[model samples]
Target chain A: MDLRVEFAGLVLKNPIITASGTFGFGLEFSSFGDLKRLGGIVVKGLSLKPREGNAMPRIVETPCGMLNAIGIQNPGVEAFLKDKLPLLPWRETAIIANLYACSVEEFGDLAGVLSGEEGVAALEVNVSCPNVTHGGAAFGQDPAQITKATEAVKKRCGNKPVIVKLSPNVTDIAVCARAAEAGGADALSLINTLLGMAVDIKTRKPVLANVVGGLSGPAIKPVALRCVYQACRAVGIPVVGIGGIASAEDALEFITVGATAVEVGTANFLRPDQSFRIIDDLPRAMLKARAADMAELRGSLVLPGQ
Target chain B: MVVRNCREVKVQSVRFLGTWDEASDFVELTLENPGWESYRPGQFAMLRPKHWGLELPWGRPFSISRLDAETLTVFFQVIGRGTSRLARLNPGDEVVVWGPLGNGFSAPPETPTLLLAGGMGIAPFRGYIENHPTPEFLRLFFAHRVPLANYPYLAMAEKVRAEAMQEHTPEDLPRIIERIRELMDENHGGIALACGPTPFMRTIQEHAVAGGLRAELSLEKSMACGVGACLGCVCKNGEGKHVQVCARGPVFQADAVQL
Candidate 1:
């Protein structure tokens, strides 16, 4: 069966893409499996300057999911372009850079810096990181800021497709999706992570040093699907679903809810070669679902009344 | 300059041999080796049973306690939900393991090395003691709350000059600390390697630095991914910069990290 998918002016060999932050710079996992087998890789979030991130104990496992407050610790955009990008097999696969900045101007500047790079296929704007202290989920939670940030990146991004990654902590994900569309976002990816926290009953201390973190994994899959479905209906642009997607069946669930593609996030931690395995299993998953291709199954959800 | 060895790491499915109770709470697990490249002494691996579902999503990181021609051994105490589940595995059960990860202990072969460990901290020394070129020159001082019979002390003691101390109460800490200081004083100009609880490690680190002695420490942190991608297992360095423990080290120089 054909597994190719074209969305937001980019063609993926398959609908399987590794989410940002989880996949590192794409080189760390190269030893686990062939990097060329993946349809796309969204590298860790980059900023204008290197970030030290939060204190120790930045993650906590809760039930089937995990919460992280990494605070988008990266080596800055320049270091990535000079040191990391040259080593990736960008010629065969899409290398999307995830951007993190403290302000609209910085976001635009970061977009300008990466958009000119030949190896970077696209720019993923990270307005939904719940771990940082400022200018993260704040921009994603406010419709006006989301529109402004998307517009800022779009204006300076040149020909590179700008994907606004939205937050699930917001009240109405459709409103945020429409806001990005209003600012001319080529596509949208949701949801970044839900805000949550854990506590140690014995020490009476917060589990994470940052106290609150973004929740991801199988626990957040239903919430992610709900956000993606609402956002897909509200906007004309393609939506890439992310959040706790572990298996090909999970990827198909997002596709069935109107997502053009799905990004494997937290599962990459559970198993480094998870994305590659998902890609290999997609054709079999499609056959089991009795579909000719992704298009045949895209948004095929049935309503009870209908 | 200290040269660290880098090896190719891969995920493989191995068969569980069975569990051997080292003590009431501590157990040793043996697995069939699937022809993984040779691993150094202080390195570790992430292990998960194939039957595991979402209840415990990530694998637990364990120090490579011992490695023979055909089998790998990992020792741990029943700590939480993950270990509790791991302790119940049957023989021949399939388990997914990936490793020889993180930088391993690299004490200069010529130097007389003092292996200081506490409780479960003694896990990695079995391989360290057996694999050392000069096993005769190695000395181990293990401190714990339980009896010496509860640990792999005797097995390792046969390979090196091993000694054990029991800390029954907080008041017993100074006596153990005094023993460590005495060991450091006697082994002056030599190197010390340590692993254990934070305070125990901190005590060793403090004395090592104050005495101007070279020391290496193996740190433990709650890690989601044993790889560096998640950035979850980071600790501040001596320079106060955060470095990934899983990538930079689960083992670091005494002066390299804050504690």
Candidate 2:
């Protein structure tokens, strides 16, 4: 009956949190449902300075999935703290600030700045964003860079838990997972979209203006599951799963595979109240799996001992 | 209970009004009004179409062309797969729509309104002219590459009964500006409102700036979520700040944006 989850040291009401980029500043979706009822709100990815993202046609649709290159467009750290932070109902719900920067020092500075601010329960280091020109995928793809980014964030994040969101484009997700855990990450989240591209045959041009964009949604769910499963096995810290999670059944799959929590991304675009819908449906799914609480569902996947 | 006003995205079945080929690749869709009767002049609706297990995954934004108390209409050109699928549906067939969304045009009703429309940009102005409190003070300058054969323009002109002017030579920007100036002069402090291709809108913005004519423009962007949730439909302001076109203003003051 208790749906509470300890995600990255923060006690969330439920496991369903709105993914960073999809939820905007969390204020926009208040019209759809009660923000306080959900587990948490991960406001869109923020940077040290305001980023003007890519050109037009930053998104395209594939089979049951979507590709977006919305380059972590935010109002910078100062504006987010001054304007967006106060607007959040911090007393009622968990507020996770998803942070991105072009360099290790910038990541530390952003984390440091956010640490001093009240109401920010956790810091989600968005090193895996494929949309930015630099410092995003560059930091996520390599274990060394991932370790450095994690260390930078962990150093100045104070008592706030640091969650390093891993990129799926890497060859071995486990290696990056180990690196993040080695760098003192309290928890890990995967997968932050797969680097992919779509083409418009009629125009003989790439559909997204950036040519290559990060593909998310149902199309990448399988890949996400595999990565989350691998990352969970590789690291000792808690792992949060995100990718194409539209239903309670989808969230259960992640939990069964060892993800302590899940974030709903692209589904929010279609159904704004998806987090509440998934939270509402979670109990039925857990009951079907014969699990009394969410804690029992973690790593419950039965694999054949070959 | 405090009724929180949230935009609802639903799968409502819309009956095809008519498909006009003479107008060169344009389709008009009609749907029974869902709860709310009226939206702002330049506000739009999102169409959800699925085929071959492939969907847009998000609502496709289209300006509301015409609306009655009981029904709402939208006009769109076959630009990509989304609109192509919409073109295939028949009058009796059903298509899903999420509607009456975004901040629309804002102009003082007391001022004489000059509408500059290029190609299919005439869609939103139809609703604007119809919904205006004082319709007689409205004037339209519609530009197209060829002769006027579209049913929408004719239907709009007839329904609104306002002075509608046509320009066949679309490339003649100087002449269009001159015409706008003459209309502004006649109205004694009139404002221009335009919707069209980027170049057309840009030229209108340019003229509106130079002539000191207060203007508003409706922009077109490749959108995912018609609601403000997705940061996909962002347009840069004159200050180069990224503003959500769906949340802030699909219709914005001419000088506020970079076009």
The lDDT, on a scale of 0 to 1, for candidate 1 is 0.86
Q: What TM-score does chain B get in every candidate?
A: 0.90, 0.83
Model number with the top DockQ: 1
DockQ of each: 0.46, 0.45
In angstroms, the error of model 2 at B17 is 6.0
What are the per-residue Cα lDDT tens digits for candidate 1 across B26-124? 768777764565778888888877788876888889999988777778888877888888777877777777776788898577788999999899999
Give the distance in Å from residue B249's predicted Cα in candidate 2 to where it truly belongs: 1.5
Error of 1 at B228 (Å): 0.6
What fraction of native interface contacts does model 1 preserve? 0.54
TM-scores, all models, native as reference: 0.94, 0.89
- Candidate 2 lDDT over residue span B8-75, tens digit each: 32223434334445433666767555455667878887666423233456657889887777676788
Instruction: Give the DockQ (C-alpha) for candidate 1.
Output: 0.46
lDDT per model, in order?
Answer: 0.86, 0.79
